[model samples]
Target chain A: MGEDFAFWLAYLTNGKHLAFYASFRFTILAAVFGALLALVFGLLGAMARNSRFAPLRWLGTIYIMMVRGIPDVLFFLFFPLAFEQSVEWALSLSVCSAEARAGSAWPPCPAANLFFSTTEYLILACVSLGIIFGAFTANVIHGAMRAVPRGQLEAGRAYGMSEFQVLTRIHVRQMWIYALPGLSNVWLLLIKATSLLSLLQINDIVWWAGQLGSPNFLPQAGLVHGDWRWAYYTVLFVFYIFVTLGSEQVFRRLTAWARRGMPLEA
Target chain B: MGLLEAIWTDIQLLAFPALFNIYFAASSLPIGFGLAVLLALGKNSRNPVVSRLSSAYIYAFRGSPLFIQFFMFYSIMLALNPIWWRPMGIAWFAMSPLFIGPLALVMNTTAYTAEIFYGALRTVPKGELEAARAFGMSRLQVFRTVTWPNMIRVAWPAYTNEVTFLFHATALVYFTLPVIGNQKDIMNKATELFERDFNVFLHFSVAGLYFLVITMAIFFVFGLVYARMMRHMPKERQPHRPRLRFGPKYIR
Candidate 1:
């Protein structure tokens, strides 16, 4: 039994398994940066939707409706590809001759073609994650903004706070209480979306799991193991469940903190 | 005129692909809905083991991403193929994405839908249940007359959202499952067209348009059902009957 335990330990700590462990960082990084971007985009979107300016409101409305209507996987795949093509299109205009531009192939010329490394792909994934969840966050924040009592804003005005001050201090500050639940929901979604980081060619945990779990056969040593993909994927399935559970606990505390000393009288 | 013609052609090409998506959702939803009702009742069951099992199942599925779920289940089914599926003489059907895709989707939508139904079950108006019991109705009769109606009414709006998201999730099927021959869904076909001409904007926009139009169609049909459900209520108190404007939570 002791020998068996040692063999299992050695097997798990092999180079590939260690790399699988390291690949988790990409998932965490995407979630963190993606969440921050989503918050920024959400605040802007909700504010625009609530804007006094007609065009801005229309822009926000269109943004929310359009993004929310489509499945996230589409945008997740589209944005990076679109961004690359747009850059290439601009590059072709500057570098390629007019005749070259008339060609049917992509990039117009070889010189204008761009390849993204893992870092760029990860960044693109983050941005796409932001755009998708940002719409969700905007909807949540917009509703929460309306849920804020008018009397609170009126009190800020009565106290001589400027319009911006009233918003930043009273309205937006208190909006957290209502928005926390929805934002947490978005966070759950955003983290789950981090699984798609591999689709952009970022070597994330999901990619590693698929690679490591496939059956291995060595020419010299013979069969290593049959397919263990189910085991690896089960680990991932549980990993996400834990992430969700952890986020819920943290959001619970955040909601409590947001509501602290605010008084039920409001 | 050129751009319009290209778009019209692309739309025509995508229409066939779009049916694959519609088939995935249409095939899975009825089974998902039925199982969801049972799972919801299981969660709400008086038996502790049943309740715990149902809760754990819901929590696990709900907490995880559907993308991973698809990959996980597909791989597991593959791993089981040699031992379990192939020997059973049904691997041809069991191993196909047509079978596995909706199977995974059923597992997923069941969780989300059951959660909604469970919430509705909880909010089924205790007074009404008691009133029904006091009238000497049996449990099954109480369920049919009082509990079931209240549950459907309370759950319908959320269920509509679940259905839309389920439809949206059909996009993920081809991503994880192996495509047979030319059978492709919206995203797959769009990617293929993009690879051909490199017109990322045109193809993707048309694809996105398909999803958006189908989502609205789902809402329109569900809203009609919702309106019918709430017909007994006073006109003004009917919550405006699911107006087409983006109220909230279109695609969860």
Candidate 2:
């Protein structure tokens, strides 16, 4: 029993396994940065949707509608690929000869071909996540803006505040309380999506788990283990559940703090 | 090739693959709907064990990514193949993506749908329930007469949104599951086409068009049902009823 315990201890702490452990940063970074971008995009989207200008409102409608019917995975995959190719295409115009450009080939020539390292891909994945989830966040924020009491805005106006001042000081300030619940839900969805980062070639936790848990065979360590991916994935399943539990607790507290000094709704 | 012809060919190619997605959603929805109702009822039950179990099931499934759930369940089935499914001569039937795809989707959607139903369950009119109970109605009868209709009415709009999300999630099935030959879905086929021509724009847009059309179809049908359910109301006041609008409701 002691030997078995030692074997597992040594095995889990091996170099490849350490890399696996470190790869979790990719997931964490994607979730944090992706969510920040989503909030920014969402604020922009909501502001546009709420704008008086017809053209600005149309842009927001298009942005939000882009995600409405399509699966997040489709957008998640397409946006990065399309963006990479677009950049490469632009480069090809400047770098490639006319003959190379005439060829029906991607990048038009070798010079235009560019590779994205893990970090670059990670950044792309974050932006893709932002663009996809931002629509949901926009809906939540827009609704929250409307939920801000009209009287509060009126009082700000009565006190000689400009429209921008009333918006920033009164409407936006009070909107957080109403938006917190929906925003919390969006945050949960964004974190869950971080699991797909490996699909973009980012070496996230899910990728590492699959790699570490596959059957290992070698000249010296013959048949080290059979398939253990289920165990690895089970850990991930539990990890996410814990994250959700923690988020729920944190959001509950935030809601209580936000509700302070406000009269209770029946 | 003419641009329209190229699109036509691409759409025609994906036409069969699109059915695979429809199959995943169609096979899962009714079963998921039935299971969700039971789960929601279980969560609301007086029995502590039942409530705890159902609520935990909902939480676990809803909390995690469906992408991981697919891998998790598939890996478990793979591990089981040598010991159990093979021994029983059922490995082929048990491990097929066709079977497993809907199975995971049903599990995932049940949790989301149950939460919606449970929320609606709480909002059932207390007076109506009490009136039924005070009239000496049986427990089952009170639920049948007073609880079910009101819950469905209240839940219809959100339920419509859940159904659309579930349909959208069918895109993830092929990513985790092994596709046997030409059994690819829309996403799979689009990626394949993309590799051939590297036309990221055309293939994916066509794929997105298919999802958009089907989603609209779902909204239209559900709206009809919602409208029918609200027919007893006076017309003017009934606009507030939960009709499945074409635009965004809550989405995942």
- Per-residue lDDT tens digits for candidate 2, residues A136-207, read 889889999999888889999999999999989899899999999888989899888899998898888888
Each prediction's Cα lDDT score? 0.90, 0.90
TM-score of the A chain in candidate 1: the value is: 0.96
Residue B211 C-alpha lDDT in model 2: 96
Residues A88-182 of candidate 1: C-alpha lDDT, one tens digit per residue: 99998999999999877788999999999999999999999899888888888999999999999999999999999999999998888899988
- DockQ, all models: 0.67, 0.60
Error of 1 at A240 (Å): 0.3
Determine the C-alpha RMSD for candidate 2 after optimal superposition of all C-alphas. Answer: 1.9
List candidate 2 stretches off by more than 4 Å.
Answer: B240-252
- Where is the poorest 10-residue window by lDDT in model 2 chain A? A61-70
Q: What is the TM-score of chain B alone in each candidate?
A: 0.95, 0.95
Which candidate has the highest DockQ of all? 1
- For model 1, give the RMSD to the true fold: 1.7
What TM-score does chain B of candidate 2 reach?
0.95
